[model samples]
Structure formats: C-alpha cells, structure tokens
Target chain A: MRYLLLVYAAAEEAAALDTRLALELAERGGLLAAHELEPVTTATSVRVRGAATLVADGPFAETCERLGGVYVVDLESLDEAIAVAARLPAARDGVVEIRPVVRREG
Target chain B: MSSVATVFREEFGRSVAVLARTLGDLDLAEDAVQDAFATAVERWPRDGAPANPGAWILATARNRAIDRIRRDRTLAGKRELLARLEREAPPAPADDDALPDERLALVFACCHPALAVDAQVALTLRLLGGLTTEEVARAFLVPEATMAQRLVRAKKKVRAAGIPIRVPPPEALPDRLRAVHATLYLVFNQGYGPPPRDELCDEAIRLTRLLAVLLPDEPETLGLAALTLLHDARRAARLDAHGDLVLLEDQDRSLWDEARIAEGRRLLDRALALCRPGPYQVQAAIASLHSDPEPDRRRIAALYDRLAELAPSPVVELNRAVAVALAEGPSTGLALLDALAEELDGYHLLHAARADLLRRLDRPGEAGEAYRRALALAPSEPERRFLAGRLHELPNGG
Candidate 1:
C-alpha cells in the first residue's frame, strides 16, 4: 500500500529543516521514493466544476500551518507506514497527516 | 442501594448498547434500558440475582417498550421500530452476549468526528468513563452547565448526522485513533498538570488503560499510555513546596516516581520494538528521553531533530529550540526561537522560550517583552504568575 504523508510547518521552521539529512534518512529507510515540493510562495486550491477548476488563494481550509511538503511512501501496512511516518522529522507537535492514496483505474 | 441496583449501575452501559443495537433508535433504547435497570433494582433484592439476569432485564425492557409504543399516540408510526427492537431484544441465555461490542461501540460513537473536539472529549468521558457531566466539567475546570450543553449537543449531532457506532475501517482508524488518543491524552494531561487534581488524573489514566487494553496490538496506543505514564511519573516533582513551576532539569530527581517511570519505559520499549512509528510513538520516544534520571540533552536534541523532521510544526520547533538551548547553547536556541516567534505569535510557550533564551543572552529588555507576551498568553494562573515573576526580574517591568 502507498500512503501520502503531508508535512505541515510554519514557513521559517520549514526553512531551517535539514532537508539533505532528512532525505538521507528516508533513503536509508527505503522511504526515499517520496517527492520533495519546492517551498511554495503561493498556494491555490481548486474545486472542479463541470468543465473548470475554481481556484482560490490558499487551501480549501485555512489553518495556521500550511502543507510544507509531501512524501509518497510505499509500505506493507499502516503499522509500517506509521513507523516510517514516526521517523519523519515532521511528526512532532506539528502533524504529518497520513492518508492512503487512491488509485484511479485500478 | 441493593446489590441489584449496584449491578444495574455497573452494567448500565452494556445494557444501553445492547438495547440500542436491538432498538435501532438510541433514544428509545436508552429509555427502555433505563426502565429495565430501574425494574431490576426495585425487584432484584426481592427476586434475587435472576437465574439469567440479562433475561430478566431484557424481559422487563421489552414489556416496558411495548407498553410505551402502545401508549404514545403520536408514535403509532414507530410500531415497526418498536416491534423490531422487542424482537431483537430477546431474553438472554446468560446476558454475557448482550454487549459484545459495548465499550468499543460507545467509544467509537462518542469519538465521532462530526462533533466538535470538546464534545468528543466530554462524550467519551461520559459514556466510557461513566462520569457525570458535573464530574467531567469539574475535571476540565469548566462549569457543569457548559459541559452538559456540550454533551447534549454532541449527542444531537451524532443522532442527526447518523454517525455509525463502529470503529472506522482500517484505513480510517489511524486518524480516528489520533483524535481518540488526543482526547484521552488531553484528559490525562489535564489530570497530571495544574490544579493538581489527582482524581481526574487517575480517571484519565484509567480511561487510557482501557484504550490500551482494547488496542493492545497498536504501538501508538501503547505509546500514548507510556507517554502519559512517563510524564505523570514526575507529577509530584513538577511543583515545589511554594507551588512554583519546576523546570525538568531543575526538578528533584528523588521526587520522581521510579515505579511509574519503569512501567512507562517498558511500554515505550515495547512500542519501539514493534517498529510502528506513529505520532504517539514519536512523542513517547521524546518522553522516554526525559524519563532518564540524568537525561542527555544532546541525545534528546537528536531525537527532537528527528521528531521535528517527522512532525514539523511550530510547536515541535519550539520544543527543538529548548533542546537546542540544552545541546548547543542559549545563543544557538535564540535564533530558532526568534524564527518561531513570527508564526507562533499567540503561543505562550514560544514567548516563554524566547524569554528564557533572551535571559540567557543577557538581553534583559527583550526578555521582558517576551515575558509580557508569555504572561498575556498564559492559559492558567500558575503559568501567568510564573511569567510575571520572570518579568519582575527585568529592569522596570511594565
């Protein structure tokens, strides 16, 4: 099973992270297949209509924290995924929300 | 009260859940079960613990339900609902089968996300912990009416939204469990921290123990229990004879509860052995570092670094700032705390940390500003006073 780990953080705090070291740790743990997003200056959320995506300036839900990054991790079970998730530097007081990715045309 | 009444009260929850399953309407199920228990309490002393106590309760409940259905003119349309309930609620052979999923169902139902966070906590404590609204209110330092309204509204939302009474599917369990664990943690934290209400702390511990029992296989659950125990182990040492905030490093090592710390450490080790790293497990790992008699700030800083990466947030960063202060120096931590202040404007601990860092840097003016901010945002009397005391040390504290 594959899960998406959403990393949330304040912008400055996100900037101070040891991205290289984090990636190294993830790679050693086989969680390296995940992608790193460029820190976004702007975020626009969209909802699809009949033929259009209605874009808005931030997320659909506004929170103090923003989605700092995301990781697409493959693991055998939620337990294993959680283990990997726990190791992510992002799971402290800030949360790393883990949701299973839904496959289209599976 | 008689033995039957005691039994009825003890089994009230199981009876309610069983009845709810049979009746398919929570309100009706609750009334009928209460009526059954009432009858049992009145008759059981005279009748003795029935050969099958469940059957006696079920029989009484069914008959009472039937009478209510027949008597309520407006509920004539609900005859099918009533009949179905009565049919399903047959006399139990032993009553042991009555609530197979009673505790679980109640917990899940109470923890439904449709309700607000406060509502979830209040409802869970009420339904599973068997606590009254007044008791919960007192535990939370809120008024009974406020808590009562919160529970009432929560139940209404659960019924109105048709929230199911089952633990979410495997995929959904993590998030749901997070919420449930959070509510439980909050309860425990409330108990273990300020006001020093030992009973509420014990109640929260009891509730978490139940959760630990239910989800023994989940390392996160065990982690939560362990984290609670670890923090709780030092509860007595957190305050002094003068009732001041005692920093972890400054706390008297002898005052810490070795037994509780040992249990917590064991649970944390077991959780780590499972290699299932979730939020709770990560938090537990942090707590485990603190549980040491002579905690290594560098090791704790490394764990915080991993934790900050695993769960990046302002709060984590704030914690890492403290760890950095310990592992590196107050100056190194000051930079991190300053950066955190931009986004964590209203967070009390951020200001407190900033103040501490400033004080260490000998920047008295800035430290006073930070202390004022902390005092402004402090959530409790003790915290406010502590911040105020820190400010008093600053030149011309305004």
Candidate 2:
C-alpha cells in the first residue's frame, strides 16, 4: 500500500528544517518521495469552474495550519502509515493527513 | 434450545474470526458466517446435529464465500485472490477446537483508537460479543437506527483505511492495550451500575477473559480480568431484594461468589508479581481490599492514593476521598471533597459523598442542601430515590 502524507503546520513551525527524519524514513525502506513546499505566500491557487479559471494569490483554503510538505511512502498497512505519520516532526506541532493513494492500472 | 442454536451462540465469534482471516475481508466473512448459520437453522433440526457442527459451519461458510466471490461481478478484479483461496487446502476439521484464535486480531481492529470510543464499543459488542445491532443500541440507550449507521460507517472505515486486523507489536502494545481495556471496562461499568443488565457484564467478562488468554503475560490484561471478576463476584449483593441500591458496608457478604473472588485474587496476585502496576492493577488491588471480610480501609486508601498517582482523574480523587473517610474520619474526607468542589461541581456523586460526610458530622442543614443538589443532578431513578430517602431523614425533615 502507498500512502500520501500531507504535512501541515504553521509557517514558522514549518521553517524548522528537520531533513534528518526524512532521511531516516528513506533508510527504513519505505519512503518513495519527500518534498517540502515553498511557503503559502509563494503559493498560487487556481480553480477551474465550468467556464472560467479563477486564480487566487494564496493557498486553496485558509486554515490554522498550512500545507508545508508531502511524503509518499509505500507501507504494508494503514497502521504502518499512521506509525510513520506520528513520527513526523510536524505531527508534534501540527497535523499529518494520511490518505491512501489510489492506484490506476496502465 | 436446540444444539444448533447453542453452537451458533458459542461458536459465532470464533467462526467469524477464522473466516475473516481466511477471506481477508471482515464484511464478507460475516456474511458467509451468517449464511452458514442460517443453513444450520434450516437443516440441523431435520437432519439431527452434525458430528462436528463447527467444522460443518466453517466449511459451509467457506464454500459459500468462494461461490459468492466467483459469481459477483463487482469482485472480478479479486478473482485471482479468490481462486488462490479456493485452491488452498481447506482447514482441517477439528470442530471448534482447531480454529486459530483470530478474535484477538478482530478485537484490536475493532477497538482501534482511530475510531471513536463509542464506535469501538459498538463494534466490539456487535462483532466480538455476538450482539445484534438492536441489542447494542438498547444497551447503550441509543436509537437502533443510530447504532446501525454507526456500525456501517465504522465497518466502511475499517475496510477503506486498511486497519490491520492483528494485535499490535509488543513495543506498541501498551497504548493499544489501554484502548481495548478501556472499552471493556466501559462495557463492564454499564452493566455494573443502576438498572443493571447482567448480560452486558457477562459479555464484558467473556471478552476480557479472551484477551487475558491471548495476552497472558501482559500484567494489565490480567489486572483487568481480575478487576471485572472481583466486581462481578459481588453482583448479587449490589442491590436489595426490593431492587434498591445496597451500600457495600450493608450488603450481605455471604451472597458474594467465593469462587470468583478466589480466582480474582489469584489473577491480581499474578499481575502484582509482575511489579508493573498500571491503573487496572491498582484498581484490582483496591477491589481485593474491599472484598476482604473486614476490609482494611487504610490499605484501600493507600491503593486509591496509588491509583490517583497512576491515573489522575476526578473520579479517582472522589474514590480516594471515600476511602479516606472509611479509614480516617468524616472531617478528613470532607476536607478532601471540598477541595474538589470546583472541579466536580457537576458530578452528582461528589455532592452525594459530601452530603454523607456532612450527615455523619451532625450538620443537618448543610447535608440537606448537598443531598438536594445530588438529587437534582442524579440521572437514575434508584439514585434519586436513595438521595430523597437520605434527605427525608435529615433533622429538619429536609
């Protein structure tokens, strides 16, 4: 099973670089991809309605926490994904949303 | 009444547990088991019970599951898995004896912390306890439809989220075990209280016994089993002939189940020997003290003190105050209870305990006011009646 861990945290909290944990996850033989996004200030939101493409200056939706990073990891079960999520540094200061990746056959 | 019915009652959880492991799908396993039971109900009476009824049920359920898998169009993608399952040799027929105990796995999955506590309780009762949705709803005082919805949503989450159906690794056992223990304790408490329902208590004890067997070395598991047994041993004496509440001091100790008390004591001793006293162990120790013919209130107070340290909750403090009153005096207990006034203002038992202390201290006016407050917050008819009786006995007829 592959899970996408969407890391969300406050801007200031996200600034704290903890690349060591990401390396640890990769060494654990599960991490497929990891990337820290630019700040929400640098994000541009785009929406496609039936006829128009509406562009906004900020992220999609304003919440207490902003999307800070993402990690796609292959794990045995959701429990394993949750274990990884709990270890994320952002999990202490914010939230890590774990969603099962939908696989489409070629 | 029939042997088939008896087998269904006893082997339902075990069969479902085994089938779920074999099929790798909880819902499919349950449906298959239900179908097998229905077949038994239809055939057993006419043909006489099979020599090994459980094996018959398991084989029948497996065949039905395979048939359904092959026929269902939506399961086309899963044809390979189904074919592989069918190709494997059937489990050896040993009646109910040879079935691997997959119930512990099912129980852990049902009580996963990711689910709401109520949902965990509801799922455990429905799946592991062999309770119908309506029965669970009735036990929890919820609408049947509400419970049905809750079960559907919880099952969906179990499938969609891929919650592993297995006991957690030993290192992660403590936290996961706590959730399982808490759910069982909640079930036990529900039946241990006013308007008591013995069935729920029995189910809880049964489930805890299963957990104890599965995790024999876990001290907390043993502690919980001991705690439930000790509390349940006194069930007969918990209420009077007229169905009113009986205080522990006034209850007929002769009515207590000595066998269960002895068993509970053994479990508690074993748990304490591990020297890893968690909340359940402390509570079992307290119950052990209370079970004594001449309960050592001082030791009970000390146990409560330990319990408060382990699990710092207002309820523990309330219990500790009662123990202090028993060991020391009403004044000392009253002081402790007063300190908790702000935190436990909404809790009816706090006022009731305070009222008892005041009544003992000869403060009729204060006791009357406290009793009234307790009555106002009291949720159950028996408790309200008990408070009213106490209030009426006050000096000024309050």
Candidate closest to the true structure, highest DockQ: 2
Chain B TM-score of every predicted model: 0.82, 0.96
Model 1, A1-106: lDDT tens digits are 5677787665525632336645764766646455545544476778999999898876666676667777766655444556556665666645677676643330
**Off by more than 4 A, model 1:** A1-106, B1-12, B29-99, B190-193, B196-199, B393-398
After superposition, the stretches of candidate 2 with alpha carbons farther than 4 Å from their true spots are A11-18, A24-29, A43-55, A103-106
Q: What's candidate 1's i-RMS value?
A: 15.4
User: How far off is residue B132 in model 1, in Å?
Assistant: 1.2
Q: Pick the candidate with the highest TM-score.
A: 2
lDDT of 2 by residue, A18-106 (tens): 57767887898888998888887888988999999999898878898888888888888788888888887788888889887875432
- Pairs with backbone N, CA or C atoms under 3 Å apart (clashes), candidate 2: none
Listed in order, each prediction's TM-score against the native is: 0.68, 0.93
State the weakest 10-residue window (summed lDDT) of model 2 chain A: A9-18
